[model samples]
Target chain A: MGEEKGNVKWQMNQKCATIGFHANPGSKAVKTRVSLFVTCIVDQVFPQVGIAMTQVLERLGYPVDFPAAQTCCGQPAFNSGYPEEAGIVARHFLNTFRDSEYIVVPSGSCASMIVHHYTDIFANEQKTLEQARSIAPRVWEFSRFLIEVAGVEDVGASFDGVVTYHDSCHSLREMHIKEGPRRLLSKVQGLTLREMEPAEECCGFGGTFSVKFPEVSGGMARTKIESILKTEAGTVVSVDSSCLMQIQGAIDRARLPIRTMHLAEVLAGR
Target chain B: MTGQPSETINQTLGDARLQLAIYSATNRLMTHRAGAVRADLLPDYQELRTEANQLKKHTIEHLDHYLELFEKNVIAHGGKVVYCSDSQEVADFVLGLAKERGAHLIVKSKSMTTEEIHFNERLEKHGLEAVETDLGEYILQLAHQRPYHIVAPALHLTRYDVAEIFSKNLGVENEVVIEKQTKIARAALREKFLHADIGVTGANFLVADSGAVVVVENEGNARLTTSAPKIHITVAGIEKLIPRAQDLGVFLTLLGRSATGQPLTVYTSFLSGPRRNGEIDGPDEFYVVLLDNGRTKLLADPEKRQSLYCIRCGACLNHCPVYRKIGGHNYPWVYSGPIGAIITPQFHGVLKDPWLPFASSLCGACAEVCPVKIEIPKLLLKLRSEVTDAQRRQGVGGVERLAFGIWAWVMTHPRIYLMLARIGGIFLPLLPKVGPLGKWASQREVPKLAKTSFHQWWKAREVPK
Candidate 1:
């Protein structure tokens, strides 16, 4: 299919983007064993993102495994102020990924919760605290893992569309994953990446914040949608699924033509 | 003190005019602040912030010693210092002084502390006229309204609103022009400032070593209020103390830039004491009422005490999205916005409005712009935990606790989590819109679940040799 004006390529690309491909990294040697912690949202809602992420990892010469026992990162409970419940679930997450050398997640929100908040979640419990501390350094968001650990910038994938990136609050502010996705996206051929104004502002899908303060959340989401529309980008992409879901919901509700794609899904394209 | 924050927020959101007013005002302030910081105008901005943070930390850590030293210096400088345990004591002290001196017709400058103490109302109850001299405060006084913004008290009021207020109250022809309204207020307050028995103001910073009450403003009314009256009274929170006069340099540098984007306010008066020997045009008696008023409770907790480091710059409020949406009146106290989110709960206890802490999106914009570098987001999170813990202790939030408990159980058990996801995928579309979920769905569509889970797809694949 040609880079532009091909519905068949888009459909074929979507289907081929499924997981379970073991592709060889032609030029680079295989380096590390990374376990994929497919966040609950990606596992249940956007499975294509996980598939694309795994495909991209395989292309980067990293052996990625799915830890079946892994479940939610307990961020919802933690952020909602139920630390005891959050701690219970965090302990389970820690146990599931205990033996892995590195834990990589496609979602920056869950990844940040694990890396930044686990110590606080497990604080006062000595055993879990130690476990959390040990696991914290090994956790990496998808883009950060690709750039920082796998050391691959250009994933040899190209897309033909204008896209603007949203900085998911947790990843941008907490994990400091600002330029990682942009640097990687810049390498994709035929992709005209237009930077959105006030790109660092929250998309207002702050977990339960959307439901709790729907008016404010909806207003903020509308603001973001307007910003994305102003860029005239066909697709709005981010590393976190939660933010995408919020922004996408607003776009869909408004009946705007913009598509919300995960950075993983976009980067894994051929 | 006000209606439920949720209801008020809803009302504020419903009003398009108020939303635009708040959004534009805050946006302008935030843009100006950003430009001031980015221009590299304040050569040692970051360094000054660090020093200011350290100084506030040191003062708060040793608040008692500084308070004593502050009182001694004020006394040495011929100013009387009265330590008030609460707002009642503050009101009583002011009333007693007024009664002893047979003073009436009080003129005042913009002071949030006086608002906190309800100083004017207390005097008014005794049949004394307490007139506000600062233009914003005077406008609010004439309208019989509370401050809407911390720095710009009447920011929510448009020029048209002010014109209407002056027409109705001041009995002047309705003047739509902004400068005319200012002139009208100046003419009205000029008489009050000249004839008033006492002039009251809030200290921006109380220099402990020098016993100086530093008042920063643009209107020049605070200076006039202190200078024109026979007796000058300064009401300030005990938390407002700094160790030395040199500390003012660091604070003054940040206070203006973060507040109104000014290099320095038009007036920065350092009133050390009452009119000195042979001094012209100053008060005979100067009194500083150091108010505790639940500040000690905040200072008692080391984890939350950093909230006291706030310099009342309102930079956090201008930058906070939640504040931008809800406006200032929704906050339960005089202080609103990000600072209010932390301090309101800390000062008043979280139980009064458990939802205030959760009102924020946990955006760190407040922390980024804080002149004194208070970790506002962290404090907010800390306050959230406190609210939840309070609920737990009181046997409240049972439904929420149970729901979270079940959620935690399902999330930990992958088998159940997957089953629930599948079942939710099937039924979530069918569930009737109701309650919080209904509210969420009203504005935004819920994410549709995938037909197949990622793990299921991964497991079905054949291993490649």
Candidate 2:
């Protein structure tokens, strides 16, 4: 009974459209700004995806805020069997975003690290687990937040090219973000979506796995590159940047005629 | 790749022909499985998978009780049951019986358990002639290699390779045609099957209610192996039991579809005991050697015990991209692919094959295709922790720990991290490819950092409008 009561209070603190997450946000008007949790890869390597995401949200009539104190979600350490190291960084993430009403991330893997594995990272500490659980329901991957929570699609974006979708593993399986991203792509004015067979397979950029077993990783990526080429699309888009880096690297090595872009980058285009 | 240890990943990746053979074979199997179990074709498939998982969970949870019941029933049905703890014990028992009965030849069907124990090598070392009856296993035996894949043992071999192997081993003319080659293998093994003194096989499922061993195969070799010889012996892991005979329906329905996408295999034999008064075709003595080598250890760990629910369908192998990329022999054990990744480390210890758990990208394909609902990625993660923590305890991987420690320290401090990022953005392109970045660039180009980061752009453009 006591745990139930405590959960209800945390649920009320959720500031999204809510729906089934907490209390209904049906009639609520947004006064609080949406904070962006730009992943470490995006902040350093691919800032275009982050900017495009911010632009799309601002066009949706929601104010955006960038929390500068954020460094990373600690996924690389967490996935590579260094949980204590991941814990120290994940704790800082919890503190940095503790006061935000709504938080949105541009990458699926980072968002999953928070929503799915936070409990595991904080398993031994009850106090830290509570903090992790409270911020979990509030964290949303980019494509999912647009369709499911915000109840908006077709953010008036336009791109002139044929593109195929690459389903990053974490977003497709863990977050269940299928078709929603495609639905957003379909609304783009000049974008023609070509579906690739076996697009849901991994591109083999498994953090340290790429370096640890470079030969096998390269083999897996070559197969993925072949599948992408069969689509004959000018570009391949996905919800995560890590897979794009791997795919892009292989494409560059083979001197293939194609491009890889994050979904947020496609949406941010005018 | 300095800090990581490997057995044979580099060698496997260089063989493009072997990679294509594995990829196309697994792709064909995947297509067949998907079509056979489509939601429109089999509406109750999901429900059946759930039921099968429940049955396995219950049986494994009470394995001690169920194994006792099975042993008593086997005794009642005129068969004997023996429990062997390791491969040495198993070889000793088989060899002692062979010596007592004056047996000179042993014929085998396709039993991976025996392969796990290197049964043929031990027997031949003592000058006993043991022959493989399955066509795939026979070809592999001639080639002197382990299984390339679980279900399709010789899938990596082209017909040309087989022709060469057959010609060299049997001293026959080269036969590239598969049918003629199969005939050649059959002609060679027929004499052994008819005159061999004992038969050894593996059980797909063991029914406690009937005390029967169920062996499913597309070929008729297992049937002949069990009936053609006077003594029939089954070498099965202790984790292969089900509580009731009725549960066979669910597993039988799943096993063929998951393995080769057939409604059922060509032969589904339920062997209970020795020959009866009127049954002239059955074996005179039946023995089931239950193997426990390291299974009890898996049964004790609640966190990863779900690996025991595997029925060896090989569906996970067919769907695993990593296994397809690297082939099977690099796994350093008899079992290969996703099942081998989790099972080998547990059975053989992490210190021996530390790279097994870290071989995957955790893409969820193996778990998605697993008929028994084994959470492979989660178990792999757990095994990764075990391996890393073990290495850390022994102070063997100090460099890796220090690197991760520095990564965490930099990741927690935003100001220092931003300064480093700024420095990296300006000078990273001029820096030579070395360390981890150099390693990543070996196959692909390194990613270029943006001149202006997202945080920087957002900070400059936020006008409070």
Candidate 3:
């Protein structure tokens, strides 16, 4: 429909985004095979993130598969307390990635969608819940997988700018994936990391929360951007591209000099 | 009865300016607390909460025995413990102690127990200067106001507001930066901490096994307040005492992590008594004032006794949606949120805050995050029932009583309720957007219904079977 409207393209494009972090096939011993379940968001607005991910993954010596039919992980609907809508989304995701060796997601929100929301999403149906639980153990966020699972810290990329990381709420609190993005970021040859105080705070872009309670969401996001500005960093980097888009949108609206980037893009040295 | 609380929870609900103040501040705090706890690498977090609850419950159940043991231990360590039955008694005890010691300046850390007793004004009345040493408390002191948040007392003020207050009181100039403003406040409070004749503090926990008063703070003012002065007084509610010294670790782990979301607070001191001969920076006299002040009444009710187990970690306040929407002052008491909703009615009596218990959406989020496992929602429901029952007895010619009486009657009869619901379903849409019901409906939309009643529809559908 548009650059960022529907679910299907967003999921497809999110899968394409992870191609940027793939390992080189011939040069690597660890042989990290990853399936990119492009989250519903990247598949829609920023299909380029998916394309960039594919190119980055190939450059890093890994072959990434795009599970095209994936819709969503059911977190948005589930967290909103609508389990039935979430169930439809969860089964769609499971059927797409149930057989895959490893499922890596681009967003911590989506990753939490797989890890935590799946079981609850299918809680009523025993058979589906069992299958959902089976698929959950293998799901990992891209940054977490790149560092912890793939054993690749330096993606041999170079970027010359000052960037600070925003610890997304779900990834930082729920998944406990604090150091993964940092470990990958530390190896960016020309990049300088300026740590922001109270970086772990939510940007308050709680999905429908932005539209539903726009004032509260915008107010919280404004507070987050100010904290980013206080660090005097040229760029704000995060593993989840959605939070990046949110803070970046506010920054652009304010016409501040600061920029936002995905951890994968930074790691791929774009 | 003294200071006017918010008119109604409904009045304060969904006020955007207040929401901006509450949500932004609480979300930041929740994030900080989450980060600190994550850094600890504690695998058994759920287990830790369970252990904390169990320990608190056990300690509170045998509070008298533990208090006696704690008293004996304090005495053995050359410190004194005075048990007070009420707020007046506690104030009298502290005043008597201050008079006996010939104290002039009393540098006090943030103590909610002391606040509960209105000790600052009492001490000031007795010609003793009680200067608040905590940064947030210092800001409130300068502004001549009560605390808005438990952890961050000056949370309601913007930096500009603080600068204005400082300029007026300290005469440093108004347009100062945040750091510069803090620097001025620090410089002023540091002198008070050093020269104060008597220091007072609030204990986070009373380790009964050792008669120690544990204080946790990031500012380091508490350490200075308790140590630098010759006479040190720790005023804590009697419920603070825990049964064993070993259990301190479990509570402390959860307390610091849950309250501020830190791996550990910057400063946590367990003071047993006055400084020994070898110690250089220590107070000569130590006094632990165990204040009752309606706690014994709270302790008597088994259903409500769990309120006493509160470590004052401020976790409930952080997670509460109503508190986040309305701010703390809306609750009509010092303690607000789910915990406050339960305890306020008991302390103020059921007559004062009739609407306080109905404020919540009955979401069980508060009890989920509570470290002490206090069934806050259950207690709030209990309080609500008690308030309603009391109103039914005492509220003569009151519309509230009439409304509730009709509600009780309608709830008892399903057929009458169904008929009334059908009438309401038709007429509610026709009603004008004014008056009390309209205002309530404005905030929340009533769901549209099927033309037929559920019972009628079910009965018709079942006939084919």
Clashes of each: 0, 0, 25
Give the runs in model 3 whose Cα sits over 4 Å from its true position: A1-270, B1-18, B36-40, B396-421, B432-436, B444-446, B459-465
- Alpha-carbon shift of residue B373 in model 1 (angstroms): 2.1
Clashing pairs in 1: none
List, residue by residue over B1-465, the lDDT tens digit for candidate 3.
112243443344445565566777888888777676563577778888889888888888998899999999999889999887777887787778778878789899998888777888887887889999888888888888877777777776778878899989988889559888879988999889878999999999888888888899998999999889999999899899987778887988888888888767899898989998788877899999888878888888987898888888888888765567567777677777778888888887866866676565444457767878888866765675576567657853256445434543443344565677668768877878665434323223322344554344334545796
C-alpha TM-scores of all predictions: 0.94, 0.95, 0.62
Best by lDDT: 2
Task: Supply candidate 3's per-residue lDDT for A201.
Answer: 64
The candidates, ranked best first by DockQ, are 2, 1, 3
List, residue by residue over B324-346, the lDDT tens digit for candidate 1.
Answer: 87888888888899898899988
Better of 2 and 3 by TM-score: 2
In candidate 2 chain B, what residue range of length 10 has the lowest lDDT sum? B1-10
Return the TM-score for candidate 2, rounded to 2 decimals.
Answer: 0.95
Better of 1 and 3 by lDDT: 1
TM-score of 1: 0.94
Would you give me the overall lDDT of model 3?
A: 0.73
lDDT of 2 by residue, B1-465 (tens): 432335466666777787788889999999999988999987899888989889989988999999999999999999999999999999999999999999989999998889999999999998898899999999999899889888999988999999999999999999999999989998999998989999999999989988999999877999999999999999999889999999998999999999999989999999999998887789999999999989999999986888999999999999998999888887778889999999998998886777788888988888887888888988988888888898988787788889999989999998889889999899999888887778788888888999998778877786665
Off by over 4 Å in 2: A1-32, B1-8, B463-465
Share of native interface contacts recovered by each model: 0.66, 0.80, 0.00
